[model samples]
Target: MTYHHLTIDELTMIANFRDQGVKAYRATKLLHRSLETVYRVYRFLAAGHTLQEYYQHYRENKAHCGRKAIQLPTDEVTYTKAKVAQGWTPDTIMGGHSAVVCGRFTAFSSGAILICGPCR
Candidate 1:
């Protein structure tokens, strides 16, 4: 089955049903969602958080759920900038053939490295 994020109206409805002493199973039937999904929503509401707050927090958490960014060292960045300013190609700077420099150059060309300027 396809995944579907619950809307604010559905969350409010679940909260209201839970407040009226509805069980998780019944709420699942009412919302046509899984029991786990219904229970999760009920638990979020029971914790005294509003639907908007839950959604905001959910979005924040979702934003962080991805491949971590590559972190180039400050010294490496400085070295790259110095070399680029001296009219050295990224390939020459990294000793002719380096996968790291190649990848970094690709990322740089795509605006990841603003200080490098336009690579020659």
Candidate 2:
């Protein structure tokens, strides 16, 4: 099943139900969510966090939870720039090489290199 982030309304409902001393299972049934989801929401509310605060915290936490970004080494970046300036096509530079710096070439050809702080 596809995962769905809880809506603001759902979070409000969870807070309201918990304030009324309702059980987590009952809140789950009312919201058509899982018991764990209900409990997690309730816990956040019980910790004196506002709905917006909870949402912000969730967003901040999830922002860093994805795959780490790939960074090309400084030497490789210099070499790619020199090659491009020497009239070498991006395809030739990337061909038979394990280095994935071709994306930078495409960006350079499209005049994006100036806008990119690292590439510049």
Q: What is the lDDT of residue 23 in candidate 1?
A: 92
Clashing residue pairs, backbone N/CA/C < 3 A, model 2: none
72: Cα error in model 1, Å: 0.9
**Over the full model, what C-alpha lDDT does candidate 1 score relative to the true structure?**
0.71
Query: For all the candidates, what are their Cα RMSDs to the real structure?
Result: 6.3, 5.5
10-96 in candidate 2: lDDT tens per residue?
Answer: 888888898899999988888899999888888888888788998898788767754443455676667667877888876776663
Q: What is candidate 1's lDDT per residue for 12-115, written digit by digit as tens?
A: 88888988998989988978998998888888888888888888887777777544556556766777778788888755766743534336454466555433
What alpha-carbon RMSD in Å does predicted model 2 have with respect to the real structure? 5.5
The stretch of ten residues in a row with the least summed lDDT in candidate 1 is 111-120
TM-score of each: 0.51, 0.62
